[model samples]
Target: MQYRTNPDYWNQWYPSDLISESFPGQFRNWFYSLLVMATVLDNSPPFKANFTYGTLVAEDGRAMHKSWGNSIEFNKAADKMGVDVMRWMYCNHKSENNLFFGYNRADEVRRQFLLPLWNAYKFLVNYAILDDWTPNGETLPILDNVLDTWIISRLNQVIDKVNTLIQNYDPFNATLVVESFINDLTNWYIRRSRRRFWRSEQDNDKKHAYAVLYHVITTLTRLLAPITPFVTEVMYQNLVHSNNPPQHIPFEGEGQGVMSHESVHHCEYPKADLSLVNDDILDQMSVARQVCSLGLSARNQAGLKVRQPLSKILVHMGDYHTELKPEFVQIILDELNVKQFEIVSKVESLVAYQVLPNNKILGPKFGRQFPKIRQALVVADHAEIVKKVNNGESISLDIDGESVVIYPDEVVIQTKPIEGLAVGADKHMTVGIDTIITDELATEGMSRELVRHIQALRKEAGFNIEDRITVYYQTDGDIANVFDTWTDYIKEETLTNELVSGTHAEEIFTKSVKIGKHEVMFGLKKI
Candidate 1:
């Protein structure tokens, strides 16, 4: 087969060197051999040839040889840290970014993100089995609470996002969506509902929580199956079998009562129901998030932490707020840690100067009169000019022994600010910050900072969430009085039974010193 397609055979058929060697078969064979030689000789065959060859020939070429030392062997990496971990690393990577195969980054990924994810899954399963959880694949119950509905809604949302991203070859966004779901599950859903999972003997709420989480894990494993095959399979086998065992035999009753291994890889992926994804809701949330980020950034610039409560945030919108306002209001309030938000119309308070055109359009019609028109417009009262412009009438000006009319459309109008508000503006938008920080606001801010410190101390003490503690403070003047009044806040935040105010040294396990005109001390104990 090789000889028949060689240039020598073609040479005999055509009886000419150029015509024979230039034939399709000879050319193709020559290209293939050239490629093989390039790989075999260099010992560092370019893996990038896959991309370059597709560009040149508009088709996929064969994989480069392992002899070239460029072939990626998955088995070795998989051996080090399971096939699922490797699969997760590969599938989560963006297609546009070049993926360099090595041990270090892979090890880092496994240690940091992958292992934690696996541990979280394991934790869920352990508790779930102890509770004797099961999913009947039917409409079990409808949740009346907002949090429950929100989580289920969020799950469907992730499904929609993942499906769209994967279908469009945007694995980066898909990975981010998956990461967000995991975060919500671990941080928000599980953390908030931990007690429900640990409840004793046949509690209905506990059962509901188990059912909800079980459904979530099952769906999550199915979703992760494409990305992390081996781990997901193991997780599925353990979790699924514990609840419901398979009935069919693998190969003609090859095994006894022992269940056969089912590959999670073969499991079908979930299709996103577009009807479930509310774009209006998403857009509202998106705007709220944007506002929240901007507000947070603003707070950071002002050296204020997110735990501190703000009086209010004023969001200015031009026509878009009608659609986006209702959805984003609560989100913005929560994210900014504000007591309330005041929506105000007329963004002119936030806006400063607007730039007008340089009379380029009017210059053609009025010629020398353009300069006179510009002068008149510049000198005219803004309100009067605006009125004339709104009425669709042109301003008349005389220059160089000629009179000419200037249309409003020929020039631009801009707003210039004068006093009070701290204003920042661009061509299309503006933002203003109210700088009147009162003593009450300052006390509230200080209280919030104290809350943050207490939360940090709780984490550092290695105390379980249910543990009780007593807080101690060492500060003077307003700072001391602020903590005294907000002692209830401290007790609640730290899960403390009581708060002791003063420079008491006996109960101190950890000390946090805020460098300022004052100093504060706090202590915790597990009860």
Candidate 2:
């Protein structure tokens, strides 16, 4: 009847397809069947329709029902957590799988993805404002740093993955790809390159960082626009249109183009730059990160904090481990607070090994021979057993004149740290930390701790990152000597223009922290 009333509307837009309704969606097919029966009886054409189906489940893997009192009040959730979060959760959740909707999940999404993305953008904007940086139509500088190149490559890969996944109607994987890229951009790329932005000079390196970050954020906004419209549009407006006028599309006349809307929805989707994708460097970086992580874990097990200095970390890798370059190894050194790093062919000197029979399998297989097998394993030369295992060989023991060959899988190899070493290992690699500390290392650690305190005071005092301050620290003996020895390093790190050796006025921010065994009082005054 409506089509008869508006025939032009029917000609332009007829036979609309319906989306998957919440529950009891099979009724749609019944209604469509009625339309078919009517059309057949009247000798008229039936309206074309399409049906999509999915199951709806609640946060606890149960159906949403008012009788069960498990129904979600979406309006209340939206009021508390924004609509973008709900939309993000839905898009990232696979339709084939049940969505575990809850406030906790929403909070995780906020903390993990949204907060990091926002913080990255805020970091750029804050520094850019301080530097008076404005976006110009200039290409990024040729950056030789692997961190920069790696992130660019990862960004392009993300673009490709997101486009493909979305095109294939897999919004779950598409949003997941974006989430991973955001993590890389925030934690790996921005974190490693922060010093370039922190520098007072607006050099080419700083410009390159800015260009990369700006391009990434803008492209990310465009990519996320379809799934998360409101938040992306707000970000696009603030990040892009705030600095410059709205972008324009070329019109017919020369120098005449219509100004485009500032909404991210209006922007075009990002295409991957195949030239920037480097899988090899990414692999190397992944290895380096793993090494650093293992090294840090070893230190933690040794009760050595990262603020303290260590002498060396010895790394032993499996056959499949990626060979890292000197620069990549340098990342380990810088991050692990170690003076030296060595890639060793053997870890016999660093780790002691013990071989034991796996009772779960051996208990039933050998029966009476188990005792002899256990004895052989206990008395077996651990070094030889380890060597055989490392070479992918098994150990053979003659038990009561009977030869029994025990495969590596039947034995458990437990690694114990040798003297003066702390060890951590995964299936792919092992890291050993030399826990020896010298006077110099202790002094440096103390100085670093003191620097942390002073920096915290600066923040408490509302001092800007670039603000200079006068430092007054009071401590005796070795710490005083530390101050004398590493005075320049401390001053440079804390932006201290004046370093005085006295108890200053109490009006200035003052705090006392235990530096080693000595309790030290420190004060900072903004200069």
Candidate 3:
């Protein structure tokens, strides 16, 4: 393989240092930079040094080779998950490290993240259309509601994080922040606001909710434009700017159109106005979230579901009382399906439990010490440990006659149960549960499960959101009684006009239908 032996052929083809870059190398550099720039433009601040650039060679210094079957072909990946999903994978991956591509990893991304996001987006579109939601030309007004302001602040925060990460070549963090936002939108924002979208026209709050969500969806579509081009474009066309004519946004350079044709790519990244992001507001919200998580986790552990309504939840706010007070109290009550959140100062009322490390502030310093430090800290008094840690005191330990100084950086302090409360805390957060589960709560849980099943049936039956329907019950006993109790819920959920008690009814061919347990049938007709 010596080039010196074949002087004529080798010399003509390969010139040292003067040879043009290989197609693969050129493509990689271009693609990598494009993604990096897109991310930078999404957030306002630049990423740190650790976030920038990655090396291509393996630790052994070998270039990845295709003949060795170690290289990934983009076209093959595109064929499998569609181009947008592939693009998302690339945008989300850690840019500071060489990415090892494989079929399995790609499949995992599609299944665990991409598909869920797509499904959520589809759900939003389906419901929005059904509700005949359209954003009135009014701009959003500043509001005192935490939900409203929190979402806007979060949107701006995402823009900042994404831009900084992208600009600094930290695609991993960028991707993570965006993914978090998507989860928030689907699970919290949309789920909590579903009733507003479905309410009657006379409800002004419904209109305001629609407007807020509309702004959010539209802004999200634009924000995601660079990462998942095709999907975002499709979403934008279907959801936002639907009345306008189609227009293409080019990837690079200066371009203009009759309208402001500044591609979302070229648009300035959004800046976070500090006035919008209130730490106190966020802390209160965290309390609400903690309470909700505890209740939900408790429900899951007890084999109870979210639809069940508890009579009350006692929140043991040892140190967090003032923080969790009136602000998020109502939100916690709604999220936990509890009638009230009784704030308790003592742990004596708690019944069931779980404990977790408070690792957020402590993990960075004490991660190296691990099990030994954790053990010692667990037995120590909470107030004493807190005082020492806050005062910057260091504890000395004798390990094999060698003095080891356990500074604040060498140990972690966490909360532990001494008495009554049913509690749980994880690395970053904590929660507590109520022990009692009532019969009415169980029935409500069953009702919720039924609603989920009916919704699934409707989707499977190809019923559109605007479809009006009637449900027929053919069963007796508990299930029948459950349906009877929640007839109005079923009607609202299925967009049904009626729910008949009878088993048999004349069917219309044009109508969509689904049959469930014990020959219960759901019939749908487009209004």
Candidate 4:
């Protein structure tokens, strides 16, 4: 179909920039035919690039079969797993791998990725409405606040990456990068920024925090619009204030809502705000996040819940070069709920290396003598074995008078925490927790626990987030003593006007809850 011969019909869509379809079958069918027709007509291909996607299979790597009860009807899957979940699962996966789509996988996608994103949105919207914070302008705000700077920098970086990935049709990695940003946004940024939002004064810092998050989320909606049309449309409409937004959206007041745009699809794909990018903050935050991760791991290793405060953390930056500033160190300490932290060069005082056989990979290969091989590995020099495994060397072992070789992949180098101090290590760094909890530390942990209960009570009492309530407690012994000792701390956290000693009004909400080993009755009354 030459456009020169029949201009009216042929010029409508003569050459597409790209074509995408399922692999081999498309190559044999429509793809082959389209190229043939285009070549015969004008000596060219119809599209500049061709993308082929892989097939879907059951989770067990078998074809979908009704007889085997391994198949899912489209409507059933869509209705149960949700269209957004299915789309996320598809987008998050590499196009060349067989996608094992099922309820289980979809549930994981919802829990692992979508849940955090949704929580962040919910947190922002709830707090925004509580404080009556609305997007004032479209420009990204530059702030001197460490968290504000770091998150904005991250937002710009993702904008650039997602734009590039989308242009190249690399949706898998693009979604992955977005998910990582979401994790940082919810877990790190928003968690750290909560106090800024909760402060009594409506300060410039608070406004900038909301603005940065608003920009990040709305821009993300625009970027995700193509892939998740329904959710993104809903999110954009609900999140952004628009005068003419649909009735169902979360729009309350009208100013510059939606910037006169009706839908997210109408908005321009977000461009990276290069002016906001700070490589230094990004690098520092990266190390900070990884350090927090290892610190949490150490806490888990020590059977210590985050609610139980630890004394300190000892971090060894094995190869990482970023120097933790005071603020960055403060973030790690606050996040991990540790008192102090020290940077050390050697982690031997915190962790011990041991070589363990990967039973799964070696089990089938050395079936009968696997136990003997394991025994040999157990008696081997731990440090030397770790060195060999790390360097990709194989170890020779004697089992029943026969020499057996253990390859690097057949073993795992494990870092065990020291007996009293729990430690977690990875390639980049090692973090060890001070497992010794002093009386003061335990009391502080108790205070944090009380804060949790007070927040829950506020919610249970149908009180608004900004509502200040006087707290009443009736307890004896340590529970009562903790309340008296940390009265100001509790009041500061729960927005209490007063910490009363007795019960509340007969009509107000009161609940007796367990703290540690004893029960304490708590009452709340709105003022």
Q: Tell me how far the alpha carbon of residue 56 in candidate 4 is from the true structure, in angstroms, after superposition.
A: 4.8
Which tens-of-lDDT digit does each residue in 1-527 have in candidate 4?
A: 55778776776676887888998568789998998988998787798878788889988889899999999999999899888888988899999878897888988999988788778878888888888877644355557789998987887788889989988988999999998899889878998998998887898888888877876677778777887787777777677635233432212111123343688888767777687788888899889989999888878877898988888889988768889889999998889988898988776767787777899988899898888889999898876676566567888887879888989899987777777798877755778999998888888888899999999999999998789898888888887888999998899999999999897556778999999898989888899
Pairs of residues at least 3 apart in sequence or in different chains that clash in candidate 1? 353-415, 354-415
The local distance difference test score of model 2 is 0.78
**What shift in Å separates residue 287 of candidate 4 from its native position after superposition?**
1.3
Better of 1 and 2 by lDDT: 2
Better of 1 and 4 by TM-score: 4
Index of the highest-TM-score prediction = 2
> Clashes per prediction?
2, 0, 3, 2
Model 1 error, position 510 (Å): 3.5
- Model 3 misplaced regions, further than 4 Å: 1-70, 111-124, 142-144, 237-268, 319-322, 325-327, 351-423, 426-431, 508-527
**Per-residue lDDT of 318-363 in model 1, one digit per residue for the tens?**
4345445543576566656666666556665444434343566777
- Tens digits of lDDT, candidate 3, 398-483: 44465656666544444443342245544323445554657777666666766776677667677665667665544566667878
* RMSD of candidates 1 onward, in order: 11.3, 5.3, 11.1, 6.3
Which pairs clash in the backbone of model 3?
A: 43-163, 350-421, 350-422
Error of 3 at 261 (Å): 3.1
